[model samples]
Structures are given as C-alpha cells and as structure tokens.
Target chain A: MGPDETAGHYLVANVPRARRGQTVAEVLSQLIAHAHDCMDVVCVLDDDERLVGVLTLAALFALERDRRLGDAVQPGFPKVHATTDQERVASLALHHAISAIPVVDAKGKLLGVVPSAALMHILRREHVEDLHRFAGIARETTLAREAIEAPPLRRLRHRLPWLLLGLAGSMLATLIMSRFEGALAIDPAIAFFVPGLVYLADAIGTQTEAVAVRGLSLSHARMRTIIGGEARTGVLIGLVMGGLTFPAVWLVFGSVHLAVAVAVALVVAGGIATTVGLVLPWLLGRFGSDPAYGSGPMSTIIQDLLTLLTYFVVVSLIVG
Target chain B: MGPDETAGHYLVANVPRARRGQTVAEVLSQLIAHAHDCMDVVCVLDDDERLVGVLTLAALFALERDRRLGDAVQPGFPKVHATTDQERVASLALHHAISAIPVVDAKGKLLGVVPSAALMHILRREHVEDLHRFAGIARETTLAREAIEAPPLRRLRHRLPWLLLGLAGSMLATLIMSRFEGALAIDPAIAFFVPGLVYLADAIGTQTEAVAVRGLSLSHARMRTIIGGEARTGVLIGLVMGGLTFPAVWLVFGSVHLAVAVAVALVVAGGIATTVGLVLPWLLGRFGSDPAYGSGPMSTIIQDLLTLLTYFVVVSLIVG
Candidate 1:
C-alpha cells in the first residue's frame, strides 16, 4: 500500500469501546459517557486492546442489565484495514445494513469507526459529483447550492472545457458530413433526417451513459449482463421508434427508399449508441478516472458522429 | 388539519423521551432501557407530552453525572410535522448537518425522531430516482442492482415511452426539414452543419437541464438569479463556439454565406437552449412533477426541433 492509502484519515477515532468482562449496565454507562455523536454500535476490546466483537446500542438497550457485555456481542461483523477507501467503507455499510463500519490496524486493534453520518455524507457527495461530471461541469464547489449560485464567469470556466472538446468533435462531425456530400447531391432529402437521426441516437446514448455511470460503480452485476441488457433494450427502442417512423416518412415524403433508409439507420444507430455509452464509461472507470467523466457531452459527440455515419451509409445503400 | 395528516407514517416513534428533572445518569440509564435503533437524539417532553428541547446522546454523555438532564438539552432544534414529504425531511437533515430530525404533532407534541440511517436511505433513494428519471427509464426497481439486472423486456417497456415521444418529435423534425426543401435546393452545403448544430445545442441544453433539475430543488437562491446567470453562460458559450466555427466553416466549405449562417444559428440556438432547459424543468416542478422529468429524452427532441428551426431560419436569411 502507498503512504497515502491510510484509512485512519477518514476514520472517526472517538468511537465507544468496552472490555469483555464489563456488565451490560456498566458498559452502557461508560459508552454513553465516552461516545461521539454517531455512536450507534459499541466495539468490544480484549485486554490487548484488540477488537473481538461488536453490538448495536439498540440490542444492548434491550438486554437485561445483569447480563455480561460479552454475551451480547454479535459475531462475524466485518472489519476493514485502516487503508480502505471511503467507497469501500460506504459499500460495506450498505451491504451489511449497518450504520457504522469499524476501522482496524495491522495488529487487529481497533482504530475507530466510520460513523453513519460520515458514510451518508460520502454517499451524497459522490452522488452530486457524479451528476455534475456527467453534466460536463467541472464543478466550482462541492456543494450543489454553491455550484448553482456560482458567478457566470466561474460557471463558464467550469463548463467550457467539455464544450471546447465538443467544439473539436463538432468540427469532426462537419468533416464527416462533408464526406457524405455525394449522397446529399444524389438525394437532397437524405440531408433532411441528419439532425433528427443524430439527436435521437444522442438521446439514446445519454440515457445509457446515465445508467452506466453510476451503475458500473455501485452494482454488483456483471458487465456482460448490463451490456447485453442495455443493447437489447436499445435494439427494442430502435425497432418500435423506427417501425413507426418508416410509414410516417413514406406517407409524408412519398419515397419508400428514403423511409427504408431512415428505419435501417435508426435500428443501427440505436444499437451502436447503447454500446458506445456503456463502453466509454466502463473504460474510464477501468482507467481510474470517474466513469461519469466519459458521459454526457463526450458521449453525445461520439454518438452523433456514429449516427451520422450510419445514416449516410444506409441512405447510400438503399437510396442508390 | 385533515385526519390523514398524521405524523406517525414518517415518524420513528420509538425514540426515548425524558422529563425535565432527571439526573444525567438516570436519564442515560432510562434512555438505554427504552430507546430504539434511532436513539441518537433524546427528546425532552413537558408534562403534557409537548416537545420542549432535544439533546444528542453524545451531548448527554459528556454532561457531568450530577448535572440535570434539562441542563444538557440543546435549544432551537428544528422540528417538522409528520405529514412532511421525505424530501423535505432529508433536506432538513442535510441543511442542519445533523443526523436526525424530530417530528412533531400540530399541537407541538413530540411524535418521533427520523434517524440518520433513515435520512441516509432517503437521500440515496432520491438520488437514484433522479438519475433514473433523467435517463428516461421508468425504473422497475428502486435498487440499482435490480435495475441493472432487470429483464430486457421490462427495461424496454420502461424506456420506450420516452423514445416514442422522441419518434414523434423526429417526424416533426423531418416535416420541418421538408419545409426547407428550397433552402437545400439552393445550396446543399447548408445541410452539412445540421447534425453538428443539433448535437451541440442538445449538449448545451442538457448541461443546463442537469444543473436546473437539482439546483432548483436544493438551492434557496432566487429563481431569476439562477435563470439570468444560466442565460448569460449560454450566450457566452454560444459566442465562443460560434466565433470559432465561423472561420472554420468558411475555410472548409469555401462559402462565406453558409459559414455566417451556421455561426449566427449557433449563437441563437445556444441562448434558446439554455432558456428552454432552465424554464422547462422549472415549469414542470411548479406543476408538481419532478423537475428531472422535463430533461433527457423529452428535452432532447424539443431542443432538436428548435435548433433545426434556428439553423434553417439563419441559413435562408443568409443564403437567399
């Protein structure tokens, strides 16, 4: 482990603890006197100051006063090395349905507990951060209130970097569209569906990015399962949307080829959009940057280029 | 005053309450003997069961053994009616940076305390729900794990409704393009920037929607202040993007008029996108729906049609 990996920094060192021989009443009195504001569970320590077991205060409160504190100890509570990350801590708490997570040292000695309040704060902050990053805002402040109230200059500074990348992507999109100039020359109606096709594909991808950004981090589901599920859903959304649009376009434009080209493009674009959305985030997460960093503006531009390519190719294939 | 407005539904009614004159030691023992899982704050009640004051277990623990329980009570803690929404309760907990919030009856009698665990759960649930709604997923399950693992069919059902709306919008987009058949006939180069323009506009509007959806709900900042700030930011983004795109487009397409048309359209589209993004969510929230509902797929289609209108209007005026 690196020097920066210590979990001691995030641990609340003021947790309540008791020796094994203490009576329930005695332990309760001592715990109440020594514990911090978030003292939900009491840790049991041995003579060597090593953590042995733990129990919730609620369970202790329900016990008979004369009972030994050791008798009330709940076995098999999970403890983490002091070097564990806050995400791990929060996940553990959620998994165990426990309010507090115990932090320990190399000797199995109790360091402290990461309190419920801190866990809750970590979860909420991460939630807000993910949302902000997905929106392509660099986030001038951690608090949503502050982010919302930031001056226009600060807001621009925070938001411009992504849109700048978007600017570069938009230029690429222009180049790609120009490459399809022959198709436009062949059938001008081909150019009509460009914005709509790209918009729908971008929208579909954004939804997938939204799901994958948080879903990748928090869900225990296999990546294959998620990708497969989203891809199929994407295909389904495409079929219904395309199936309806096929007749509508034919009726409106009186061109069966144009209609067929659009329906085929929608189906192809939908599948690609979902795959790109899910993959970009998963890849970012694997590389240790936030998964959300790869979503929203980033994925939109990528999906737009792909959707355009798909539309132009299908139009050439069918309309020619 | 309705009979159904009982605070019991949201209340953790198992909280320990104390009378005024008990010693710190006596109260600690009594509280432990009587309290439930969420016993962080001990409520103090008067003779008629009216809420008087509150103190955390930590505060009580630090009090001298001989001190009276009344002396340990923290004054001016916020209380809410039982019928309050969970969002309000969660917000209150976050605002105060406290783990638990007390609930009271119409007559100011103590009902129960909302614990830190419950607060954490509420915030997490709302966070997940907001993300799911933003993605246009109906969310068959509240759990991220469940949502990720849901059958493709169920996922399709949840996601297709929004895409259906998007389909209708696309047809509208197609019709809008058909209206501009003469413009395409004039110079096919005008059609080259359509996908790029719509994508960038949608991206800009999405960022605004992301900010407004959460910002409006959490920030106590005035709505006009937020709107004004966002509008300025939008115009600035437009000017920068438009300024850069003008020279690039003119260089690439060798058509000064087409480049000028695209640049003007970008600036106009940027401002309109931000205004619509901010206003749509605000309006939806005002009508008592989740503000997030106004974002994602619904707003993407709206932004697309608007961008198409702005682009065509500028192109026709410039190239005619």
Candidate 2:
C-alpha cells in the first residue's frame, strides 16, 4: 500500500472477485466463508492471473440478496492500486457512507486496503484542526517538528507584494474614510464600527470561502452543488446574524444611526461575503489552485474594501 | 444522525450487522468465494459470539499470510456499529486498511454492513469542508445537513464574548497605536512597516497555524515533530516571499532604509510567526478546543499587539 511512513498506518481494503466469469454462487460462498478474519481479504483474479476486487462480508450479503446464488458478477465494483493516497481512499469511503471501499489502480488491479480505523482518527483530527485553523489559530504542539523544513517557510515570507496589494486595497478604505470624514467630524461615533464592520465582513467571507474550498477538494463532493446552495444559506444566515448583531451594536456603541448603518452593512456584507466567498473558491478551484489559500487574501481584501465602501454608502443613505 | 437540523431534527443512521464468530477458514472461504458482494456480511465468535473479528477479503488474506489457518481471531479486523457516523465509519475503514468493517450493537451483535465506498464520500466532503472552514469560510449549502452542523459559523456567531475579548486585545494595539502616534509622527517611515511586520508575523503564524491545527486534528500528521520542519519551511517560504516583496516596497517607498526595515520585519516576523504559529495550535488543541477558529482572533490579536510592541522596540534598538 502507498504510505508516507511505516508506523501507524494499517488498512483492509475490499476487492471484488467477479472477474473471469466467476459465478454468483462461487463468489457468495467465498464471501460468506471469509466474513470472519483478522484483516480484510480480497479475491485475486487473472487478466492473465493478476489481481482484481476486494471481497468483504457486507458485499457478499448485498449481492446475495439481489442475485441469489449464481448471478454473473455485475459491474461497478471498485478496483484498487498501491499508489493511491490513504487520505483520498478514506474520503471516498466517507462520502459513500460505506464501512469499507476498494482501492483501485490505473489498470484496474487490486491493491491493499485503507481500513476505517486508520482513517477515522485522522479525519476527526483533521476536522478539529481545520476548525481551529479556519478560526485562525494553532491546535497542538505535541506534533510539532524539532526542525521544520526551510523550503516552504522561505517561499512564504513575502511582505511587499501582499502589503502593497493589501495597501492598495486598504488605501481604498482611506478614500472611503475621507468621503465619510464629515460624518465622523460631526460625530466620531461613525468610525467606531468602521473597523468592526469591516472585520465582521472579513470574518464572514473567510467562513464561506473556507467551506467552499474544502467542499471542492473532495473528488466526490460536487463543486456546483456547493456553489448553488451558498447564496440561499448566506441570506438566511445573514438575516439571523444581522438581526442579532445590530441590536448588539446599538447597545454597545450607543448609536441608533450607526447601528442601523451597521445593520444594513451586515445584511449586504453578509450576502456579499457569502457570494464572494463561494464564488472565489469556485474560481480558484476552476483554476486548479488551492482554493483554500487562493480565496483567503482576495476575499479579505474585497470584503474589507467593499464593507468600508458599503458602510459609507449606507451612512450617506441614512444620515446624509 | 444526531443532528442540528432545525435545532432538533434527526435522521436515523444505517444499522450494520454485528459480528458472529467463525473460524479463520470460514472467513477465508467467503473471500475466495463471493468477493463481489462481501459488504453485507458480518463475522463474530462461533462459541461465546464475542465478535472476535470482522470478516472481509482483505483481512482474511492478511491473516492467512501471517498465520496458519488455526490462529484465533485477534485484533486488526474491521468493526463498526449501526449508530456509527456514516462518515466516520468510512474513514475508519480506510485508515485501518480494511475493506469492510463489521457493525455491532452496544452489546456487540452484528447489525448490517456499510461498505467503504458508501461512508467515505461523506467523510471526504466533511473533511475538505472543515479544512476550508479552517481558513475561516462557511460550508456550502447543497451538501447534506450533517456536513455543516455545529460548524464554524454556529460557533463563531457565538463568539461575541471572544470577539470582545479579542477586541480588548486589539484595543491593546489601538492603545499602542495611540501612544505611539507620537513616535509615528516622528517618523511615519517606522509606521510604514509596523502593519507590514505585524501582518507578516500574522501571515506566517497563519500558515503555521493552518498546518499545525490540521496536523493536530488528524492524528496522522504531527505538529510537534513538524515544528522545526515548519520553521525551516517558513524560512524558505520567507526567503521567497520576502524576496518578492523587498523590491516592491523599495519601488513604492523609494527608500532603501524602508526597504531594509521591511526586510528585517519579514525575517523576524517569519521566524516568530513560525514559532508562535506552531505553539498556539498545540496549546489550543491540548485544551481540547478546535484549534482552527481558536487561533484566528486570539493569535492575531496577540500577534498584532506584540508585533507593534516589537515594532517600537526594534525601532528603539535601531534608532534610539
């Protein structure tokens, strides 16, 4: 089996054995007999005496229910390869709601298996970590390396491009601030939520982008479906989030005018955050980029800029 | 599943067959016979019916290679449950390298079988979505309800206290900014890279947090072991990223000293970012928090405040 390490990696992939015109009865007998074992087993076939599908007890019973004893092997059983990634194999099992899945190769040969036990702990840890990372924090130190690789770190240290780009975007906020300076002059209270609103929108967009990016990464999860449902969800979430947040703003900042402005901004920002968040990940996925990283800066920049601009526009609508 | 649908809606999970005892020969016979339809079968103890092991083709062969046909059923076999999370069950199969794991009751009776192909797709989508969310985005809508329940949005929306706490932390930076307004007035040049440096550390920390948190969540990757490796990775990434940024800063500001300051900021920020980046996720993980969202505000606030404080301190080191 494909592995990055020798330790802590164990799997028991299924192999379907219906090739070479094996009858249903023969297949079922073997399946029923092998249903108890120390590890997952497979049926090896020979295109010229090669290997084929993995056999499991569950697979046997299902086919047995449908085909009785002697049905010819049906199609759609998975084949496996040695080079396949455990992570991917695990993902396939997860998406299908299966306790086990076959790992296949280019030539449709049987490989080893990625067992459920090997995958669950990893997936759970990944989910937990992803949640933490999305919130923009670290998780565990017990796993840290004494000396990390330098190649990746060196590639990540750009200040000018990001800053210049961010500055260009942040400067737009300066322009918006200037336009709204008069409002702030009348009451500096307007400035209070400017950053807050911007950060709020930034957070929302980040959330949307994170989920979309992850959804797209799974080979089985449909990207279009993810994109399709985002807007409606965003609207609903926005309505609720805005409903709760506006009064809090009013309570905390003590300005009905600014609170209303923030409310309007939240609704629009929430919608935009969802929209941009979904679209950007989709766009990144289309371009074959890591949508996760690709959407990060762009969404943040857009949200920060758009939220600020919207704040002023809303303020002008309410106060001007 | 135990669901958050409409706050109390529930969906029942597929019930799996419990294990029944069979001899190793019985297990192998099933694998050799009906390999195509093994997903439905379950194996347990023949005498006490203790569910000594799960029966799948792959595991059968593995056992065969290791032992004579007379060995007692031991560990390294597939096991699952009717109530096992569909996604988690799939992942477990892949991880343990088993084709199909047995599903048992609380008392360990066989239920039904879920093939890896079924459950794993759910796992993959959930995982990728979580990764995306780890970057601070919302999950998509069209996915199953189980995909996004209790997700970042739900938790993050409840983050008013944390947000306020982080705001208090951010206020420290604001305080520093206000106090250091005089220093910046003395030389806005120093102010130029303050945000840059802080943000750089932030970016670096973010990268580390992303990797570390992901590592922590899935026991597969190790954050502690990867820390030094990450530092090296950061250094390498910093070199490349910093290399790209230096000229850009010089082009905009037209100051060699500013370029140098920004460059220094990139280096120090990169180093420190990697350090804290690895530290925070582990700490959060140890505390049993989702390190993904956990690191966002807390780490950023800490980074920004300390970054600014370090900024002036560095300035004093150089200019004072």
Best by TM-score: 1
Candidate 2 residue-wise lDDT at A257: 80
Docking class of 2: incorrect
| lDDT (Cα, tens digit) per residue for candidate 2, span A1-320 | 12542112444434344445555566555544443332333354656534534444444444543453223333455443555544455555555444545554556555445555555545554454444333333233112221133235332332224434554554455455655556655554555454345555655665565555555554354555555456555555556656765776677657788778877876787668777877876676578643444366667677766767787788888887
Local distance difference test scores for all models: 0.78, 0.52
A133: Cα error in model 1, Å: 1.2
The estimated TM-scores of all candidates read 0.94, 0.60
| Proportion of true contacts reproduced by candidate 2 | 0.19
How displaced is residue B255 in candidate 1, in Å? 2.0
Pick out the ten consecutive residues of candidate 1 chain A with the lowest summed lDDT: A1-10
Go through the candidates in order and give each one's DockQ: 0.65, 0.18
Task: Report the error of model 2 at residue B163, Å.
Answer: 6.0
